[model samples]
Target: MNALKGQTLEIVQEEFANKILQIQGVGGFILVRNNGQLLASKTDMTTDPQTLAAMMILSSQDCKTLQSTMGFSRYHYLMVTQEKIGKLY
Candidate 1:
């Protein structure tokens, strides 16, 4: 079971890496579970994957709550753009 889990993780990481590579300006990305666990990530040295994952989870939850308050039935994606940084999900 442990070996299978490891293999699955490797496959996920590889697929994540491939997707990232296909993008043009993506410097890093994190694959996080719905429960805020870091499943797989490929990030630059300056980025902390765990911290980023936690923030993503929190932000997503907050968005959902806000959407509900605004009478929206669903929350689809969030994008934040800054001078030198951008996040899309």
Candidate 2:
């Protein structure tokens, strides 16, 4: 009895690239909607837009997996933030 989680999912997604090179770090973070859709993400690749699209799919899959594992009744949104990141130097 397999569950149909992402089968009937609708997502309104968006992607963002935070060029915080002046601040620090290289790789950014990813965000998604509650319905397993891309909300926003950051990248610096010429073709990162496309890659991020794919990454969203993977992220959704991973989230769904976790939900199934933990028996989460509903799938919610994913929030990724980098407001307060610390360094160990």
Candidate 3:
């Protein structure tokens, strides 16, 4: 597949972030590599994007492990929710 870079990547990320922000409860949007590199973000949250990416990478691994142990199909998405901040998808 072709990869996006430079200004093109930024524009795409910005467009995607805009769409995500249109959701009723979304406060932020981030794009991260599987290795925890931050590609783009649109957030007002106090946490650093790099930190969130690293944490999310770890959490996703755990989720995959749980899925395997339970004999579940591969997941298409994951969401984590906190009482105060609501959900992250």
Candidate 4:
């Protein structure tokens, strides 16, 4: 399992924060690898990064499966939104 550290982590966090700031109504955001490893996050919400990453990975896989079954092309991006929670990948 590769881990982000030191200046690399700092840079990633800063970038994520900056990107989130550009969006409205974004409570928080997390950056994770395809294998569910957390890279960085910016949020005041009390959610666990590891759990969120896992859920994201699962959700992405499910989307791919659904797309294949429907004979659609790959998705360019994915977003999930709720009353208080939203995610983009």
Candidate closest to the true structure, highest lDDT: 3
Off by over 4 Å in 2: 1-47, 82-89
Q: Report the error of model 1 at residue 56, Å.
A: 0.5
Q: Using Cα atoms with residue i matched to residue i, what is each candidate's TM-score against the true structure?
A: 0.67, 0.37, 0.70, 0.66
Model 2 residue 42 lDDT score: 58
Candidate 4 matches the true fold with a TM-score of 0.66
- Of candidates 3 and 2, the better by lDDT: 3
Give me the displacement of residue 84 in model 3, in angstroms: 5.9
How far does residue 48 in candidate 4 sit from its true spot (Å)? 0.7
Candidate 1 on 1-89: residue-level lDDT in tens?
Answer: 13254577567668767887679977767788889988777766455778878888998899888888898777667776545454545
Worst 10 residues of 1 by lDDT: 1-10
Instruction: Identify the leading candidate in terms of TM-score.
Output: 3
lDDT of 4: 0.75
Alpha carbon lDDT at 20, candidate 3: 80
lDDT of 3 by residue, 1-89 (tens): 12366456667777777888899977788788878888888888777888879878998898889899998888888888868656777
User: Model 3: clashing residue pairs?
Assistant: none
Relative to the unseen true structure, what is the C-alpha lDDT of residue 73 in candidate 4, on a scale of 0 to 100? 92
**C-alpha local distance difference test of each model:** 0.73, 0.50, 0.79, 0.75
Clashes of each: 0, 3, 0, 0
Clashes in predicted model 4? 0
What's the residue-level lDDT of 23 in candidate 4?
Answer: 93
